[model samples]
Target chain A: MNGVRKAQTSPARSRFRDEDLPGYLFMAPWILGFLLFTLGPTLASLGLAFTKFDLLSPPQWIGVDNFTFMFTQDQRFWNALRVTFVYLLLEVPLKLAFALAIAMAMDKGIRGGDLYRALFYVPSLLGGSVAIAVLWRQLFQGDGVVNQVLLWLFGVQGPSWISNPETSLYTLVILAVWQFGSPMIIFLAGLRQIPAELYEAASIDGATRWKQFWRITLPLLAPVLFFNIVFQTIEAFKAFTPAFIISGGTGGPVDSTLFYTLYLYQEAFAHFRMGYASALAWVLLVIIGVCTTLSFLASKYWVFYEDER
Target chain B: MSAEAGPGQVGSEPTIVGVIARHVLLIAGSVLMLYPLLWMLASSFKPEAGIFSNLSLIPPSLNPKNYIDGWNALEVSFSRFYWNSFLIAILVVIGNVMSCSLTAYAFARLRFRGRNILFALMMMTLMLPYHVTLIPQYVLFLNIGWIDTILPLVVPKFLAVDAFFIFLMVQFFRGLPRELDEAAKIDGCGPWRIYWMIILPLSKPVLATAAIFSFLWTWNDFFGPLIYLNDISRYTVPLALRAFVDSTGTSAWGQLFAMSTLAIAPIFLFFLLFQRLIIRGVAMSGLKG
Candidate 1:
């Protein structure tokens, strides 16, 4: 297909020589943006990572000191890292599981599926906003709805979910899980792509529905699942707004909800430790890079692309 | 791996038990998902003292006092925040649709030298977390005195910094039958004319998707406005909403909820009206990426 197009376009190639100016002209905005916003700042941050710069004064060359301090001296750095990983571990699987189950249910051809999907997706639409975060704070307060429900149902007083250090991170995790609509939508689309005949064939062979799911659906859905996992994992890692707002921008109550990005923000803006924050940013970049690379590597074993088959 | 009993197959007239069970589960989950929002809406209409005293979504009385009080609760009236948010979101939508489609058209239809490398770099930007670029971008903007203005938030959109939309439109433009472009070319429609006339008209769905998402994300964005604009008068909805709650002192919970409902109302309405486009966008972007 591509070969034929290339051959056809070969005659147009001569025209493209003249068209090159317009092509680059069309691309001017993105090219300019890439150079200014993405490439330039990325390179600048790399340089800033090696210097001791506060915004008030000029940067002094500090060879590897910021990284050394982050690794050796900053317990909060480790705490932020641990908090982020824990959030990722807890949030991604639970959110995906919730999304998948709801998607499967929706796939069964329920009535008003559109309405249900819309209702289910509303939280995600509003999930990252300051209003939702503020609402979450109120909902999880000691005397809030969550505790009120607990008290009414089980006759037991519940701890302040958002304020307590031990459970604070979980509140954010719950918030993350609540916004499973995006993954659910993707999963639903994936589910629809599975040929109905596959299930019909399995049923004819006396394969139970569960067996058909394991035999047909799971394998077919693996690629979509993998996409959601990697996407959601990266999102979970960079999660800041909920934690930032829930903890009042302090990441406080002994830093329980101190997300990595929030901590980076605090270090850069609050403390004006631009160099250290730059190091933190680079570390985050490396971590995300490593995680994405590992997922792609691991996908070879599990992810089953339809075209590959 | 078959469950004890699977839900009935699609297109085979589902059983009553299956339908009932499905609605039961869906409604249960939907309530859980929507309860917080409902509570907020209910709390917004409740009296100040009644907000925390009860868990009921029903307000004792439908009072407009919270809405009235919250309108001017901040230093600037809530209308200013709404105007700032709407203005920024509209600009962002216009900028993203205009620029991303142009970029996507170039990559999809008009190949130039170094196109492959440039395309790969654009994709890489999708994975690069904003944090890596935040400080330097902030410094760059700061040096240029663009900080505290809407320029930092609005200018990047016009520059097509959002690669997701570019990738989305690329996928869309590639799906367009090449015959149309060829037909246009034979008629002496140059690349620019073909793009503006043929591609843009045929690409309404993706363009609408991009516009909706750009609008939604920009309106809900907190961190950008938070970092760039420090002045209360310049605050967007998200930032202004945050100002309602004074952690140290008394926060007017009813008024906060009132304002929050106002802040989220437009987005909710947008989602309802264009849910199909938004969901399609998510599915397309996720699967393709």
Candidate 2:
């Protein structure tokens, strides 16, 4: 058997080692796909930033014109940036706090914990979809569930959440916060990793429950907390479906829920400003990258990796 | 090993004030989480006029006809939409599992030239906001004539386009014992055999994790289907629901809610059936890694 196998393999073995080939062979499809799809598109998007392509005509070589328009004269660009920043600032912190609080509660050996976790997670899974956004619009509409409940409970009228300019943005913010499950699950996992002995030691040392949580739990869970915050922050900045559906694909009632991605999408697909949208896409990438980097830099002071210190 | 083993033995019953506060907070939070769903169910039974009348958690009377009407009103078959989503989600899950796990296995265990750089590049893909590549991706799909079909939705996953899943699988693979591989090699098994017979079996927990997440994300995905699938017949549930609402100008709230409930039901059923796997998967995929 060995002689026969050797005879069969000798020709190919002389040409190339099988072990060396398998890994590359296994990886070849992925590598090829990434190059053709992601890598090429990334480079093209960057190049398109310098052109004036709109899909209807050949891309004109209008060097720096898109970026120039975006920076020097675009009111809507600034508006989108303003809207997205305000959203990130409010939504990220609120979402983290809500998830952390719920995770802490979940960690306390609460009864029906799994049910609660599943319940909280449902909204997160639903929030990213256009259907949920439609549901949200209905719930917050003038004659929707929210208003009905408000009227029933308090005998007061409620505003049209998707249409009212003053409150429309806040409605989307609430939608963002409602999808806190992913982060909460992370927090719960982080909480589980905090050894019971540390809490015992703290309690034995006369620390109150809150104090133990503040000192032992908070410090130890910092790495996980940091991860949740960074991930949620990026996600919040990418908020699109809710805004798009709620705003009726126009980014109005007065662009109140005009998230950055939604605006970029409009530029690309709606108005066929592919080149200019490409520029906006690049700018958004830089913005997100900078935010993520800043989060990592700030983590040095707070996020407590086990071996890093 | 369990809650019974823990040291929370302070069994003193709380005072009335504490009891009220705790119950109030707990109930309030639970209501906040459950209210929308409850209202959705109730609204689906409410008459068109009753929809915005009381804003109450309870409807005055049930209108079962709304569901019948909603089903009949869709220009395209709703069952076809469900089939589209279901088929695409299954394909995505299977593709993601095989391709992502293979790529992740290579990254996690194999030592090769430029391995670290390639891994870093994969990680960098996660940081690149998806919208940046979405337009170009759309154009590419258009050029390939795959835009009008479900190919755009499922094929990329087969190519391991999802860096997040790859990262997740890499983390899971890293935590596994190296002895498993060595044992397989000593038994004269090749890498593929080891991966198939040993690593894959041991990876059930994380594989379930990847599968459940992929299923949920794929099922809930609207933007990809919305962009590529211009044909109404090819629309997924989310896209179909959007179309349903758009056609009516102000959709019959009761029927719309019913349809929304139907759209959400499959996922809810999935969560119920595999609750344990999902919880474990969510835990493993989180920062505890």
Candidate 3:
């Protein structure tokens, strides 16, 4: 529709008069996918959030009932929300701190940085796999290596961390922090963008190492730090595979590791509560959306772009 | 790469003690980082009896039994799972590279009406969480009888459902000199010819990046396979790995570890070979403009 209007409005803009046919033909698959897969399904998810639908029966529009049920009725919904926020708030900063700290250390032009980089990166590379999840379960089980180490070192017995309701979520937090290489690399790249001369100037001004870090590094790295925080927040909020695999897809041990996605999976796939799950999904979208918008808005206060303003 | 921006070396050159201390700290951190994976690898090597009791890093004997037995631990051999995952990953790579690049070509070079609006819409998808579409998509597939099959996972890739690749390729395509397109057009070449001959040939890096990530992500994907593939015979490696955890007995972690080790082999090998490219790909994505 806009093609016709644009073709009429601005014929001189196109060298060949109009690219409607060729462009549409090339983008046909994506456009079809947008309509069929993403856009269509997304709109359906919103509509379904308001109704009751099982595959057996047609959708029954019960206006705002699903939302009401979520807000007023469900215990697991509140638990899932609490768990997700805890995980997100805990992991984002923990992960980014490790990332930035290590990125700073490795950014020191250390020899064998590649080997260290590879070892550091391997976890993040393999972190999403079931193998890592399986390994995490093994490492923190009652008779696991972690307990073995604790006993061997401190002569203290550690509980089965993965199965312990009190510690299961922390294990996931540790897992999140372990895969710090991706953000660390980003921090490294961000550090690279900061001119070395800034540090040199600080040194010439008799700035201490700690002073240079605060004066020259943190402020300049704020934008990248902001990006990492925002990026990691979204990733941690959506964390499912490790939680699912480690918790054996139940988010169990009394739902301590019940990530929001895991709960949504159970609601939708396990129970086939498509409508309720849609409501849960919309809540998640809002959470992620709000967190992202807030981060962007909040960054204006704290994120110092050296070049932008 | 050698440029140092970290603030520690600020006032003076480092002393030998400081250098040694830093090296020791880094090495310690590196060991800590790799310990879990290394422990898994070691456990995979140890005999079943010693796996739990032995906290040692090295196995007493390098038993190949777990690798052999775990291969057939299930009703179907683990090779089938590998093959299923491999097949799906290859298809996903091909679909993503072809479809995303095609769409990206139009976005980068073609002056279509609604181009900017569509591009913005595509970018919007980069942040839109997939869970919002998960149930409706499941219903969509169930209605079409495509549930419980690889079609649900593999087919959307062909339609460029992953907008990230489209965006990545668009960035790379935009970097190419547009004069080349005009030159090709003057030689009686259509946009398709320019895309196939001029653009694709020059786009090997971006294409390879897209393909590698496509394969890696699909191989690592658990949710899609978990939700879609019901039969054990059709399970991907990650799904089979999860199922192994479910089915394994208390003493069978050795076998689970074995299979898990095999599951990581492709990614490990990919990292070994393409470390620079992989790291660069991640770094580039993180440094989004």
Candidate number achieving the greatest lDDT relative to the actual structure: 1
User: How much is B179 displaced in model 1, in angstroms?
Assistant: 1.3
Error of 3 at B80 (Å): 0.8
Compared with the true structure, what per-residue lDDT tens digits does model 2 show for residues B130-235? 7777778888888788988999899988989888888888888888999988787667887688778887898887888888889988998878887889888898
Q: What TM-score does chain A of each model score against the native chain A?
A: 0.95, 0.91, 0.93
Q: Tell me the tens digit of each residue's lDDT in model 3 across B1-289.
A: 1122333575345566555655777799989998788888888988887877777778878888989999898898998999999999999999999999999999999987899999999999989999999988998899899988899998999999999889888989999999999888667788899999999999998899999899889999988999999999999999998888888846698899999999999998988888888888888887754
On DockQ, who's better, 1 or 3? 1
Which tens-of-lDDT digit does each residue in B1-289 have in candidate 1? Answer: 2232234363245667766777889999999888888999999999888887688878888989999999998779999999999999999999999999999999999867878999999999999999999999999999999999999999999999999999999999999999999998767687889998999999999999999999999999999998999999899999998877753223588888898899999998898789889989988977857
In model 1, which residue pairs have backbone atoms overlapping below 3 Å? Answer: A210-B2, A211-B2
| Poorly placed runs, candidate 1 (over 4 Å) | A1-13, B1-13, B247-250
The C-alpha stretches of model 2 lying farther than 4 A from their native spots are A1-18, B1-24, B54-63
Indicate the fraction of true inter-chain contacts that candidate 1 also forms: 0.71
The residue-level lDDT of candidate 3 at B143 comes to 81
Question: On residues A1-309, what C-alpha lDDT tens digit does candidate 2 reach at each position?
Answer: 353356367844432343445667667657876887688889889988899887878788899988888999998899899888888888988998998887765564455667777877777766587667778888788877777777888999887877888888888888888888878888888887777777666666777666666787789888888877777788888878888877778888888778888889898888999999999999998988898899899888888789877
Could you tell me the interface RMSD of model 2?
Answer: 4.0
Query: For residues A1-309, what per-residue lDDT tens digits would candidate 3 score against the true structure?
Result: 454467567666753346778999999999999999999999999999998977678889999989888889989999998999999888888888888888877776667877877788888998678999898888899988889899999999999998889999999899889999999998888888877778778878878677888887888888878878877888888889999988888898999988889999998888888888998889999988998899889998988665677
Which clashing pairs does model 2 show?
Answer: A148-B55, A149-B55
